[model samples]
Target: MNLVLTVLEITAPVFLLAAVGFTWVKLGFEYRVEFVTRLAMTLSVPCLIFVALMRTDIEPSALTTLTLAAITAYGVLTVLCFALVKLAKLDIRTFLAPLIMGNTGNLGLPVALFAFGDQGLGYAVVVFAIMGIYSFTFGIWIVSGGGSPTKAIKEPLVGATLLGALFLWQGWETPTFLTNAIELIGQMAIPMMLITLGVAVARLSPANLGRAVWLSVLRVGLCVAAATVVGLWFALPSVALAVLIVQVSTPVAVTSYLIAEKYGADSQDVAGLVVVSTLLSIVTIPLTLAFLV
Candidate 1:
């Protein structure tokens, strides 16, 4: 009963907001979803990440462990996808990004917060910060054939992460006013991202759903299973293990859609994967956590 309530408490708002966004679309709220997603990705989400990281104390010891875990988890996922892609003879340029990009920011971050509160949030943020840098740099190199590497390097959120770190490095306190403002904007990231997600979902057609569903299932199941076995062997903390597991288990990120759209991959396929995996994740994530607990 408690677990059921906990799942609902954590996830209900997400589904409800998605429904609201869908309804607003049906009701002719033109571009509602697009507007929200653009704002969230460009501003609110970065602010949230910056504030979270800045507010937390940097523990070098724990940082090493988290970094190792992230590298291991991501590295394993990449390898697994590569093997699968090759074995299945899938098109690498179009399908690889979607298959490999885990839902670190949206689903993973929230689950981390719920499972482990502030600590989990911080750890998850750091893992994703590292992942984002890699995704933009190495991911772009792989996807875009090395042109405009600078474009990949210059994400607003990267700037925000650096600013937050600079504050920490310089030992400067965040002014009360600035901190408060950042907090307010940061809080908007999660809900807005979800709504943007809904907009993305609303756009997907049934024709693409078949392939997307297969990819999503394969991505989630294989990646999470691999992470679970490794995490168990590492003797990571329960919360940390849970965090890593959930992060790896999440569907291909919505960013996969954007990247696919840019690089001429099947954007429809990517979006469908994102939407299906995210919805399916509500069940898979909590169950994975329950098992870990």
Candidate 2:
């Protein structure tokens, strides 16, 4: 019972803010998704990542282990998803990216922050960084049917992650005034993302949800299993392991749909996967957290 309440407390604000966006969209309010996304990614998210990494209490070595663990887990997920898509005879371009990459940023970061406080956010940021780089580079390649991976370098969060990691390693801190300013911007990340997520979902026109349902279930199982194996193999502490599982098992990202649309893949199919998987998460996330918390 205590665990149930703890899980609820951690999850409530996240979905609630998202609900606000969803309802706002339904009521015909104008929320510019592309603009909000640009603002968050270009400014707020970078600050959040830098601040989290700089303020983290986790040792650099533990972070290194988590970093390696996240990479391996993603590698395993890539292989597994590829095989699943091939066996199912689905278009790899449309399905693989969404399956391999979860909503680690908008969904995963907030969940980690609420569940495990700053330490968890710190760990979550590491995984988010890894995912961001991988998704931008290789994920774009897969979605676009071959492309230069250099675009990942253009993302502001990439620089922030590197700079923040450097700060952690060298025991550096920004001046108090700058830190406060950066943190104030960073504070916008979670709510902005959650609301944007809701807005995006409300606007999406999904397709073939019956197929998406089974694929989404398979995705959740495979992702959590891969993370669990990698986390245990690395002997991650409880919080790290829980964060890994939760992040990996997050729903399909809205970015996946946009990438598919931009690259002329089957965006409708990807949209279905995103919507079905996200709604399913309302159940799967709490159950997983109940056990983990």
Candidate 3:
């Protein structure tokens, strides 16, 4: 019962609300869904990241570990997914993005907050930093299929991160006006994200369910295994290891679908992958955490 409530508290409410929103879209609230997701991706999310990074108190040692961990996890996953494409003779473009990009920011952040409180959130911040940049850079490149690696190397969020870190380093508190503005915008991030998730869910079809589920299980399972080994090898604090395990185990990111749609890849498959992995994650997350935590 306690575990059930805990899951509800951490994950289910947003998802339930998402279902409601999904129903609304099914009934023709399509514009609202687009508005919410765009608001999140363009405004609220960046504000949230700026505020979180600004307020987080990071340690140098932890930052180092986070960089190493992020690189190892993502790098290994990329190579493995590429190999899987070759070995399985699957559509490389269709599977690679969803397989390699887990929902590290949205789901990962909440799990960290639940598991380790402020310290866990702190660890999540560092992990978010590394993964966020990599996602924008390497992620865009891999999914874009532009045939030029340079296109993926630009770092838009790097400026935001550096500015936030500069303030953190200076120990400067955000002035009332700036903080208030950020708070206002950041407050919308979750609702917008959930609404987007709802709309994305609404768009999923049965066509790709089988392959998507199989790929999702393979991607998430391998991600957890690799993260666990790396965490153990690096001797991360148990709580930090627990956090990494959950983060890496998260479903194919919602953004994976968006990116696929953008790149004219297999958007249906990516969307299906997102739905399958997210549904399965409720069980996988706690199971992995129970053992690792």
lDDT per residue (tens digit) for residues 1-293 in model 1: 88777776766775677676666666768765557766876788788877877776755456557668777877887888888888878777766766767777866777677677777777777667766776786666567776454664587777777776666556676889998998899898876666666666676652377776777778888888777777776767777777778777777777777777787766766677777887777678767766754
Mind giving the per-residue lDDT tens digits that candidate 3 earns over 1-293?
A: 77656655655654565677678778976445566665665677667666766677665466567668867877787888888878888777777867877776666776676666666765665666567666666666777756344433344334555666666667777888989998698767656665566676777663468877777778877888788888888888777777777777778887777777888888877788888888788678766655654
Flag clash pairs in model 3: none
TM-score for each of the candidates: 0.88, 0.99, 0.85
Model 1 — TM-score against the truth?
A: 0.88
Q: Identify the leading candidate in terms of TM-score.
A: 2
The whole-model lDDT of each prediction reads: 0.72, 0.95, 0.70
When 2 and 3 are scored with lDDT, the better candidate is 2
lDDT for each residue of candidate 2 in 205-257, tens digit (9 for 90 to 100): 99999999999999999999999999999999999999999999999999999
Order the candidate numbers by TM-score, best to worst.
Answer: 2, 1, 3
lDDT of model 1 at position 287: 76
- The 10-residue segment of model 3 with minimum total lDDT is 149-158
Could you give the candidate ranking by lDDT, starting with the highest?
A: 2, 1, 3
> Best candidate per lDDT, number?
2
Alpha carbon deviation, residue 207, candidate 2 (Å) = 0.4
Clashes of 1: 0
lDDT of 2 at 27: 100
